[model samples]
Target: MDKYPYTPGHRGIETSIAAAIDINPKLGRLQRVSEAAIRDAGTQGLTADELAAKLGQDRCSIQPRTSELKRLGIIIDSGLRRSNWTGKSAIVWIIAPMLNSGESPSQ
Candidate 1:
């Protein structure tokens, strides 16, 4: 028996969550939109408007969902400061690690 049943991949978290969302169409759409926003922003960061435009969504719709996604740990926020923006619009998000079954990394 192999000690490691699954080969770790760089795309693990995104791939797994995406697969889960696929079974639930509503979740799939939300994840896709959020993922695209993170991708488009890259490292420069994105405001709500920017993300909304990129995902073809209204600002109101994107903001709350993005907040929810961040809380879920599916996305990570840099929490950095913006040059001129007055709110938390400068947050940069990325797909975070997905821990293996029965395993947890030290914080």
Candidate 2:
């Protein structure tokens, strides 16, 4: 069984909930693609918009995967903001730094 890292909120309309459930099976693969896209951005990192553009994907499809990645500590907010398409400032997401000296980052 493939246990997902996150699930949709129950408060949405039935169709939305159903859509989320339908996408559950693919989230892991999508997360991997999103993760790699963010990682490939290197030290400059990437805004969610930049990532969606790089992946040629809808931002809505990508955001949930990013949320899961952040929960897993696979990525972090870079403390930097970049102007998005609509001129609003957006967070920069970066791959979380690896721990040194054999320390587990989550612990």
Highest lDDT model number: 2
lDDT for model 1 comes to: 0.52
Query: In model 2, where do residues sit more than 4 Å from their true spots?
Result: 1-4, 7-10, 99-107
Question: What is each predicted model's overall lDDT from 0 to 1?
Answer: 0.52, 0.79
Q: Alpha-carbon error at 21 in model 1, in Å?
A: 19
Clashing pairs in 1: none
Worst 10 residues of 1 by lDDT: 1-10
lDDT of 2 at 71: 79
Model 1: per-residue lDDT, tens digit, 56-85?
876655655566555555555656545323
Superposed model 1: Cα runs more than 4 Å off: 1-27, 83-90, 97-107
lDDT of model 1, residue 81: 45
